[model samples]
Target: MRILISLCLALGGLLSLPAFALSDSGQQALGQLQTRWAEIRYELPEKQREAAFAGLAKEADQALASEPKAAELLIWRGIILSTWAGAKGGLGALDLVKQARASLEQALAMDPKALDGSAYTSLGSLYYQVPGWPIGFGDDEKAEAMLKQALALNPKGIDPNYFYGDYLLRQKRYAEARAALETALQAPDRPGRELADKGRREEARALLAEVRKKLE
Candidate 1:
């Protein structure tokens, strides 16, 4: 259950970037991918998520076939792959995560600022969440740097702040975690993202409650 929720980390809401290169059909494809991802992550039952995410990943892959150079599409593909890996947790999922990391890295190289720096946010979350050393590629130092870069790009974005706060909480940095979650709560509502904003605020509030318990 925790993994399910954590998988949603670092996914920015309703792209705020202009995404100048995507055509009308590409934009529509992106929207479908986003809508489907949100539905699978937030609305689907936990037991059913693995299959759902697998399906979505295939859909995203098919979309990418046409718009291979679209950075935003690549980001969504990475996001879907990450969530799918979470849903299918175990050694078998490592390949999916690796693919996700590679896709996000490619997206970053193509457009670091795309989707409001979501590539950085997602990549950062992966760094902290995956196991380190021989088991996986996780590294706390790299996580912090990537997350901070994401925050620098979108200072007031809810997703970046929430992810940063979550990472801080994992490090037992309660005060900093609380501050970041508070900022997430205070983040402005993004246009066309009412559902994501509301859901994220609730998550921030839940984490804030946990952080307050630590402070107490």
Candidate 2:
């Protein structure tokens, strides 16, 4: 009887092992997909951005359905939707924005600290971009709060820093914007490295030049 019980326990463990391995594999694949998505977004031509993001959004949707509670998948979905909305333009974009916000909110509710507050960063940027009317959607105060929460979670994250810096620059808070942009520029992550080194380099340099002009 003792030997039989031991064998049963061992068999149970073996049965469960595959599930654990599969979950780990799924998580790793999601991470790789995210990295690739970010890299391609920066490298791809402007005209191609929409189609690329749509493809990613479809993948993310399938992944989310497969792992309903996966915070990472939800975050990726939100990112893709937000990008899609941005690419398409006009009020038609609001539907995608709302979808992105819902997904991010679900992600945050599932795990507030997931992905180093990535959900918060995405939500913050979304709010910052929306207009502040009854239907428009922008809220500067909420954007600032969310961005600050993200920074608290991961001070080195590039998205929060870059978006917040852009907000400050728009507000003509040059000093603060410069500090935030510089921090974003110095981030060690893939998104930061790609943005600062590629698409945004010229823009950032021009902004810095403008700052110097204002100072002089």
RMSD in angstroms, all models?
2.5, 14.4
Give the per-residue lDDT digits (tens) of candidate 2, residues 1-216: 111000000000011222113367566656655655655556677688778777878888877777887776777788778877776667677778889889999988887677677787888878778666676567888888998998897775555676667777767888888887777667654532343245444445556567656656
The digit string of per-residue lDDT tens for model 1 on 1-216 reads 123224674356445544448888988988888777777777789899999999999998998899898888899999999989898987777888889999999998888889889999999989999877787888999999999999998988899999999999999999999999999999988766666677778888999999999999
Question: What lDDT is obtained when candidate 1 is compared to the true structure?
Answer: 0.85
Give the winner by lDDT.
1
User: What is the alpha-carbon lDDT for the whole of candidate 2?
Assistant: 0.66
Query: Ten-residue segment with the worst summed lDDT in candidate 2?
Result: 4-13
Query: How does candidate 2 fare on TM-score?
Result: 0.79
RMSD of 1: 2.5
In model 1, which regions exceed 4 Å deviation?
1-5, 13-20
Off by over 4 Å in 2: 1-22, 190-210
lDDT at position 28, candidate 1 = 91
For all candidates in order, the CA lDDT equals 0.85, 0.66
Which pairs of residues clash in candidate 1, taking residues 3 or more apart in a chain or in different chains? Answer: none
